[model samples]
Target: MLNNKRRFSLMTTNSHSSSQKVGTINGTKVNEMHAVEAPLSGAADEAFVTSLRGRFVEGRFVYRQIFAIRSYEIGPDKTATMETLMNFLQETALNHVTSSGIGGDGFGATREMSLRKLIWVVTRIQVQVQRYSRWGDEIEIDTWVDAAGKNGMRRDWIIRDHYTKEIITRATSTWVIMNRETRRLSKIPGEVKKELVPFYLNRIAVASEEKDCEKLDKLTDDETSERIRSGLAPRWNDMDANQHVNNVKYIGWILETVPIEVLEDFNMTSMTLEFRRECRQSNLLESITIPTTRVIGESNNSINRKPHLQYTHMLRLQDDRIDVVRARTEWHFKQKLQ
Candidate 1:
C-alpha cells in the first residue's frame, strides 16, 4: 500500500496545493480508504509515479489530478451532474495553464497584447461521458494540449476512476485569445507561442473522425420544426469574476428549452457545445431548442431497452439575431433509484 504522504506528493507538487478530498468518515483520514495497492519493487514504484505525475506525450506535458465528488455536486440520482464535471475540467485547465506561466492576470504579459489587455476564452467544447460518477467517487483527470489554428489552441482531457482506472469521460475544447476592451479575437502572439510550443501534443483526446469540431448544427428559424423559444437574460449571480456570463449558466439555459418530460425522465449522455460569443448582464437572448427525430431502433426499442432523444439547441440575441451558442445534446432514460 502506498503511504498516505507519498500519495499526496504524487497528486500535487506545490506546497500551496488547492486539492480537496471528500467522503471522509468520522475520525478517519481523507485518504485512508483511497490508498492504492501495488508492488513495492523499484519498477512498479516508477510506473506508479509516472501514472500519477503524467509524462509528456508529443511535447505536451499531461497533468493529472484527482477530485472527490462532493454531495453538492450530485443530482437526484446521487451522481455528479454534467455541469459539475465541466466545472472541474474548466478549473483544471486554468490551473494547468497558470502553472505553465501563461495564465491569470498575466494572460498575455509576454506579448504586446498585454498592452491591449487580452483574455483567453473557450470557443467550443465536446464532452462525452461513459458513466456519471456518484457522490464520494474519486476520479482522476488527465489534461493536455494539441496544436490548433494560428489564433487558437486545443486542449483535451480524459477523466477516469482513480482506483479502477476506468475512463469515465473524454473531452476536447478550443480556445482563442481576445482583447478585453475590443471584445474581438486576436492572433496568437509570437511570445505566447514561445511559451506553449514546448508543450504542444499531436494527439487528440476523443476519437471522432467523422464529426467536425468547428461546425455545429445551429437552430434555424424553421416554422416546420418544433421549436421552444424562451427569453434568457443573465442575473447577477450568473456572472463570473471575468464580468461575463458563467459558462455553466449557458448549460442551464439550454436545458430550460428542453421538454419538461425529457428533463424529468432522461439523463444527458453527451453534449457538444460551440460558444460563438460571450453574454453579458445587459444582453437579452432567446434560447431555442429543436428536437431532432428519435432514431428508434433495437438500441432504443422500449421492449428491449430505454428510449433516447437528441436536440439541437442555440442561444441567439433577440434584437440582432446573432448566435451566442450552438450545441447538440443526447439523453437516455435514467435508471430508477433502488
Candidate 2:
C-alpha cells in the first residue's frame, strides 16, 4: 500500500490541493491528483511572518513537499543527482531564520514602510539534475528568501532525504510581487522587513565531470561562419508525454556537432545551459557550443591539456527565437586525448 501524507502550510489553512496527489497504482497512472482545501496552520499574516522572520535570523524552515520532478534534473546521467549535491545549500538556507526585529517581509509580503507593498510570486525556476531519486524516497524540502528586486523578492530551495539528509535536488527561483489591485510590481511594506538581511549564493556550482572548464564568452569559435548540417529529423520516437521534443533529446542534438573523435574521446562530465525556449517536433534543430580552445579560467589539466574540459551547450530549432517553446540543456565534456 502507498501511504501518502501531505504537508500543511501554516497560512491559508487550506486542504491539500489536487495537484499534490500524483501517484501510480497497479501500473495505472493517475493524471491529476486532488487535495482538499486545508486550513491555515495559523493566522495567515502571523504565520507568514514567523516563517520568514525565522529564516532571516536562523535560516531554518519546516520542509514542505512540492511536486516531484517526473524527469531527471541532470541532462546526462542518473548516477549523480541534483539532490545529493545541493542538500547542503538547501538544508542550510531552510534551517536558518528568526524574527528578531523589523525588516522587509520575509516570506511573501513586503514591508510597506521598509520596502514597499507587494507579494512575492515565483517568476522563474531552473534545475539541473545528474540523477533522479528512486521511488519511496520521501524528499525533504525548504527555501530562503533570495532577494527583493524592483517590485518583488526571490527564493531558492532544494530536495533531500528526510533522515539521511542527502541532497537529491537543487533549484533557484525568481519571484515577484505586484500591487494587490493593479497587478503591477510593487514595493514591500515596512512591518514585513526582517531585522536581518538576506544573503546571496556566491556562485552557481555544477556537478562537473571535466578537469578544466570554460565560460560561454570565450568558448565560441566563429559561430557566424559555421554552416551546420542537419543529421536526422524528429520522428515519433523523439516526442515526450508533453507532445514536444523531449528535453534531454536536445543534448543529443549538440552531440551531433561534436566530432566523433571528440565525442568518443571525452564523455560528458559536467555542463550548464539556459532554456530561453522550447522546440516542437515540427522543427529541424540546430546545435551550438563554445569551442574548447576558446575556454579560459581552467588551467591545463594533466594528459597534455585538461584531460577533459567541462562544457555548456544548447539546442534549438531554426528561427529559434520565433519557434522556441521551452528548451534548454547542459552537458560536460571529457578530453578524449586523456
lDDT of the candidates, in the order given: 0.73, 0.42
- Which residue pairs come into collision in candidate 1? none
True lDDT of residue 312, candidate 1: 81
Model 2 has an lDDT value of 0.42
Global fold similarity of model 1 (TM-score):
0.76
Sliding window of 10 residues with minimal summed lDDT for model 2: 1-10
Clash counts per candidate, in order, are 0, 78
**Model 1 per-residue lDDT tens digits across residues 251-295:** 888887788888778777778888888899999888888876575
What does candidate 2's lDDT look like per residue over 110-225, in tens digits?
24432444433333444543334544344445555544454445455555665576664555554455554444554544344442233433223223332123333322235513
**Which candidate should be chosen as best, given TM-score against the real structure?**
1
If scored against the real structure, what TM-score would every candidate get? Answer: 0.76, 0.38
lDDT of 1 at 2: 43
- Kindly report the root-mean-square deviation of model 2 from the true structure over all alpha carbons: 12.6
